[model samples]
Target: MAAVEECVVVIDGANVACQKDGKVHIPKLAAAIKYFRSLELAAGRYPVNCVAFAPNFWLNVKPSPGSAGPKENGTMETDDWALLNQLVHQDHVILTPSQAHDDFYVIDYAVKYNGFIVTNDMFRDHVSNKRIFHGKRLTSNWVRSHCIDFTFVGTEFMPNPRTMERVVHFQPSATSAVTTSSLHDSNDNDVEAESDDVQEDGMVVDHKGTKRSKTIDLSEVTYYKVPRELLPMLHGEGGETMGKFQEYTGTYIVLPSHAASAAPSTSNVLTLSIYGPEPSRLQAVGHLDAFLVQMQQQYAYQHQQQYMASQVHQAGMYPHQHQPSTGTQDDQMMEIDPY
Candidate 1:
């Protein structure tokens, strides 16, 4: 009998473990392995050759009393220790060093095996860095094709076929040519609309007001407004803040330098064009709001310091005016100088 070729897969174990409502459930990792193995066998798509890479922290978790199932313990569950041990025994689990990201090892293994990746992570930060294998660059297209996403329905593993397809694509308005990736070099000066500028409705209006249709999927884009003053803080030093936030959320965030908005309005706000899944976009929004609160607090503290400094300066200039009354009422009244 001829030997069947193996279909290799590199699973992001940390990503898989946290698949259930953003909380780590070790059973999900076990279920994921079983699901893939069963799927390969059912489809007869060659013997499943899969390996999952995880951080050492998960490997160190101690299992508590449970019926070999998921048990909620604070933010994570670890009752599936038996399954984890089984995977380890089968040499299916690989643990990354402490405090090191498993993503690097996962992608490395995938490249070495020329295998598929299974994770919901978009890997936005790593995708741009070219990982060439078999003459194929691990670009957005490659990721979309090779990555697998899944969800859990009451501990039942349900794989999603349309992996990363729902991720929003970005298109800059006609008034701006800057995208999220190039936010660092973009000028923060107000962007005046050119003769031909496109609006949110995908309508390109010329200086003469002749409107033409431009194809854009508005559904994929999310628009958020922040105070114009926060542009510096939001962009950070060389767009560092925006870059970190984007990397953290796996989303693209562009702040066009204009009053230019999705709608024609004269508001003192800068519109943030965010591109990603809905959950990612919402997460980005929360981050932005938190940043805003922090900036407001800093500004308030600075204003208070300035106010105190000014008060001290005034007191120094008019020392008598700041002195407290030290005399009796009658003495103080006479000291008022009834000239």
Candidate 2:
């Protein structure tokens, strides 16, 4: 199997709100870049690419008066929306959506890729409604959760130096492969196999005649519905409430009634509180950082090993038991294993 490639970090320039100080306040974007760079610095790191898109308006404005302007404007209202459109074309990794709008684009992408969506939006709880749109509605919370949960891929919620609430980890769908032998099977056998076993949902038949499927247990899934008005205050969990909230029972957690009315001491202070599986924010961040470091190291090691193998092959040092062979029928028939 081929090695897993590095994750792509897509920055939503529109969702990046500018503060009164004229600086963007997106620590998530910064963290992503830092993590990716760390991987590159390690040996044999897969490429970690980044793409950023702002409002067409930003693209329209010329750096110099003589430059041409952007072709269109107002295609997207906010940076978050711009980012969502950019993510639609991507094929892998966890997609981190900002807590803006309903984050419908995030949900749509998750469903399409069978990937995870990472966000701090409290309204994500409402994903269980199973409401149909354009004639289709998700019947299972597992599907809904996969579309909305912060940690759908594995663990959700890691720590950030800038925020008390933990960040999320998103994972892409797994790729399956087929073998050459499977494709050559007789049609009669294929028909008999198809008749004996029905294909289930989320199952794929590979070119090599291998069947891959994911079995989801409906009993284990839970769905929560949250009101829209309270969304902003319930957007993200704060460090102060991390302990209390993480212990809560519901699939989703909201701020206490009184807590919603309170204002942040400073604009920089996170006002929302989100509760989830892991309790400690710092520990979560440390774990994620460690995972990234490990991946980087693993990639480096693999590259080194491959380089060494190549060198050995080039030097003609690969093991051979015989003296150099001469042209002969017996020599031509002799089998050798290439390492």
Candidate 3:
């Protein structure tokens, strides 16, 4: 009889630790993992023939007395360590030796075994330019090839990524959603709409008045006008001092939240609803801030480079006639007497 081909998975044990109200909830973590495994079995998929790399403390440490397990007939029993030990010994999950670079280890195993990786990390956070090849390897090998996303939802492990549409976004949470083998899913479908040359009193021409940007041909695109007070907050500038334009009413700014087809207008201030189940939100404010800051930095860098080049050229043209200026180089004109 031919032996069944093994279906292995490389799990990031430490990454799967559950959190509740911002701290690790050991019992919850154990319960969540159990739930995660059950789902796979129910789907007729084999349990992970896998290695879980984590710190010694994580794999072996028992929770404090009365700190874990659910009440059983009016008695709370067992902690995460007890649970971990059982799972490790009985289940197909093997506890790997403690390692600082466990993520890399997981990636290596996946590559060697032609297995899938199960973790929320993108492998980018731990990588630098020095590890460019390593990063690329992890991304192309594990992420692109096969990735089983596992997330802890409320009190249980959500094994299927498809059901993650219900995960609330942006809002503060004890534990944010985690995807095991995701690449840089840049939710930046942002558009930087150019202000039409015909601007009178700061209002850009809505040339195709009420007509949406062509890039996204959505059957329905919802736009929301930010509260006049929150207007300053959305200006990309630190919402500190008010700009002259911000103090007035009717200075409407639209935030594109949900679109049936694609993202909003080609305007810089936009965000994506990447997590699906279309949130009734105006935008992902973080993306908006990022887009604005990036644009500002690019613009500043361009001007600075231009200024430096001009200075170098001027000095080269008149090497002998060079004289130190009284004011800063940026001060093109000195404060001189009108006389």
User: CA lDDT, every prediction?
Assistant: 0.56, 0.32, 0.39
Top candidate by TM-score: 1
Q: After superposition, how far is residue 27 of candidate 2 from its true place, in Å?
A: 6.4
What's the count of clashing pairs in each model shown?
0, 10, 10
Superior candidate under lDDT, 1 versus 2: 1
Candidates in descending lDDT order: 1, 3, 2
lDDT of 3 at 109: 61
lDDT (10s digit) by residue, model 3, range 1-339: 111243445566656663433234445546544544443322353343445554443443334455453332211224555666666676534554321234546665654444556666655322211121222222222243355667665765665555232221111121111222322222212121222122423434343431232122111223332322223344445432221222221122222212211221223333222111123122433343564466555555666677768877999999888787677855742332211
Candidate 3's C-alpha runs over 4 A off are 1-4, 20-23, 26-51, 59-62, 68-78, 126-136, 140-145, 162-339
Best by the lDDT measure: 1
Q: TM-scores for all candidates?
A: 0.44, 0.25, 0.37
- TM-score of candidate 3 on Cα atoms, chains taken together: 0.37
Worst 10 residues of 3 by lDDT: 168-177
Q: What's the CA error at residue 263 for candidate 2, in Å?
A: 24
